[model samples]
Target: MDGDEQLLRGRVYGHDHDDPDPGPKAGRTYAELVGGPLDGLLLDIHGWRTEEVDDGVALTTELSRWPGGRALYDPRPGEPRAAGPGIACRFYYSGDTP
Candidate 1:
């Protein structure tokens, strides 16, 4: 496929780079990213566990300082919605992962 096509299918953090208005996809649930560089990004949590969502997750992003690096994202201070609807929760970008 072409670059644009690849970007659509290879989205990270639920963001389609080519799409102007990227948000939570229909029929799919996601967690909205809050602070840091990855703010406003959505993370798909189709089959995540409570601990995984409560603890946090590391998301791969090209925006990291190092190549193929991942960014640490944690849920909001008091909003741990592992069973919420649509945008289940919000994960804030903490830092880059080694």
Candidate 2:
């Protein structure tokens, strides 16, 4: 949803925040989904493209690892591919990043 966007400090992913019908079980809110849990802090990244999968996978893998942080990649086979090489998907992290 990115509705309560206020300078995201930590990495967040999946689901929308603006939607009210969270779902049958009432999924977690945007902030809670991204900022909550705080269990180990999970980062999600998806890269589209049959060939660029390797290139993008390497990137998110590096991003998720932040000394005390972790990240994961789920290409989903066909999420959304970039136009060429300088677009498609972009990732960001926080706290003493590398």
Candidate 2 per-residue C-alpha lDDT over 1-98 given as tens digits, one digit per residue, 9 for 90 to 100 = 46223322323433233545322121221112222123222223223334554343222223344643444332344445444322233332222223
- Model 1 Cα lDDT, one tens digit per residue, 4-95: 23333323474568877565555566776667657766678867887788888877777776657888888776765646446666788788
Each model's C-alpha lDDT? Answer: 0.67, 0.31
True lDDT of residue 87, candidate 2: 26
Q: What's model 2's TM-score?
A: 0.24
For model 1, what is the C-alpha lDDT against the true structure?
0.67
RMSD of each: 7.9, 12.4
Least well predicted 10-residue stretch by lDDT in candidate 1? 3-12
